[model samples]
Target: MEHITSVHNPRIKAWKKLQRKRERDRSGLFLAEGRHLVEEALKSEVQVKVIIIEESVELPPEWQVSDVEVIEVPEKVLRELAETETPQGMTAVCERPDRHNLLLESGRFLLLDRIQDPGNLGSILRTAEAAGMTGVIFGEGCADPYNGKVVRATQGALFSMHVQQMDLEEAVDLCRENGVPIFGTSLSGSTFTAIAPQDSFALLLGNEGEGVDEALLEKADQNLYIPIYGRSDSLNVGVAAGILIYHLRGD
Candidate 1:
């Protein structure tokens, strides 16, 4: 293992650049901070390029790292690369999984449209994974799934979930072509219970403030909404997603 004590090291500077979306996009890599995320990345198909640990921190014995490069850095250097306020001592530089070939033939999927909040996006993804949904499709204006807050909020779901970014209309068209029903959530739509549980379908959720895009809603096979019986006018997008994902998944 190599020990790097300086935050100004060339490699450290390169890794730090991943904090920005442009760098992540250009390099096709991102940082997985903390132990849980690093461990999850190692277990997933995603390729972990290198593991960086603070010299004072020890990795779990069970983690397999013989094939991966391990580097040691001082706590200050680790903090330079960490997104969290308190550094977790371990982080990994991982290649972003290729999602270009995701199949749309059959399975339960969560399609997000312009979901801006990183926390909301993360929670929705974690819920989708737990509900056994096939994957997640991110529409334009949605928070970058690789954002630090989003990644941490996922709680390791980022490694296991199949996520794709594209225009939602194209996704809707693909689902329609594949015979998968698309359900959009909206206040004007029918109650969610009105629709029968589906074996395979796509649930289209919208922004935090605005509901699903009106144009996209128009294209959906059906539109539905969770009833707001309480004084509250609406549910948080993440909360609403949890309710609808499980109901639509019917599992």
Candidate 2:
């Protein structure tokens, strides 16, 4: 196996660059840190170009890495590449899945608009995957799914879930054509419980502060809101998403 000791090594420098969204976008790759996320990437359709392991850390014996390039680096190098406070000693450079040709299907989906918080976006992705969402569509102003904080926050769900970035108006039209109902969450809408859960639908979630955009809400077949029974005026977007996703899934 190839070994690198210096953070200044050309390859190490490039790997570190993956921390930035612009670099990730230009290279069509992102870094997956920690053992669990690396394992998830290897198990999923994601193409892993390289696995970097700290020299002192031993990987699980059962991991099948013969087909992929492996590199050994010192603790300093791993720390330099890590986004978290504690380094996991394992990281993978993985190509972003090409989702351009992903088809719109008749199943549960989540549509997000202007979700600026990476942590919230990650939580939503994790919850959507857990709730058996077919896919997630990212509208304008949403945080990039490949952002390091977002990637780590998602645990391993980012690997298996299908996500796309597109104009939401187009996404709504496509969902409509596929026979999926578009339900936007807003304060003025009927209580969510009033609407009948369907096998196929798109739940539109919006920015943390703004709620759903007025234009998109107008386009929705129906707008619904979760009731706030307590003194709290609202729920976190991620929490609200979990409740609505499972409820709409009829689980």
Candidate 3:
């Protein structure tokens, strides 16, 4: 196993560039930090190019025999690769896993339109995975699912779910052609309790402040709202997503 001690090592510098979206886009890879996320990446279909562990940390039995290169690095070098303040002593460089669009027959789908917050996007994905949704489509303006913050917030659920990025108008058209019912959540739409959840359906969630875009809402087969009797005006986008995803993916 090779040891990397210098932060300026060419390999070290290349991995660091993955912290930026543009760099990740160019390299087709992203960094997964911490022991848990590193393990998740290995178990997942995403190809892990390298696994770096602090020199003092013991390598897990599973990783010790893996085919990928394992690098033992000094604490400082490991820290340089980590996004968090306190490092977990391990991290990996993983190829971005491919995400395919759900076929119309795929059952349940979630579409996110203009979700700008990494935390919300991450939480939604976590919830979507838990709810057993088929896939998630990212429309324009949504946060990059590969963003470090989003990855951490997802707690590795990001790797387990199918995700695609495309224009939502096209997504709507795709669903419509395939006989999947489309539902949009909005303040002015019908209450959730008033509508029936279909077995094969697509749900659209919009920006935090603006709700679903007017144009996309118009394209939905139905627009549904969660009635809020409380003084608070609206639920956080993540919270709304969990409720809608669970209810729409009925028992």
List, in order, the clash count of every candidate structure.
Answer: 0, 0, 0
lDDT of 3 at 57: 92
- All models, RMSD in angstroms: 1.0, 1.0, 1.3
Residues 76-170, candidate 3, lDDT per residue (tens digit)? Answer: 99988888999998998988987664565658999999999999999999999899898999998999999998998898999888988888999
lDDT of 1 by residue, 25-91 (tens): 9999999999999999989888999999999999899999888999999999999999889988899
Candidate 3 vs. true structure, TM-score: 0.96
Q: Model 3, stretches more than 4 Å misplaced? A: 63-65
lDDT of each: 0.91, 0.92, 0.89
Candidate 2's residue-wise lDDT over 115-166, tens digit each?
Answer: 9999999999999888889999999999999999899889989989999998
Candidate 2 local Cα displacement, residue 82, angstroms: 0.7
Q: What residue pairs are clashing in model 3?
A: none
Better of 2 and 3 by lDDT: 2
Worst 10 residues of 3 by lDDT: 97-106
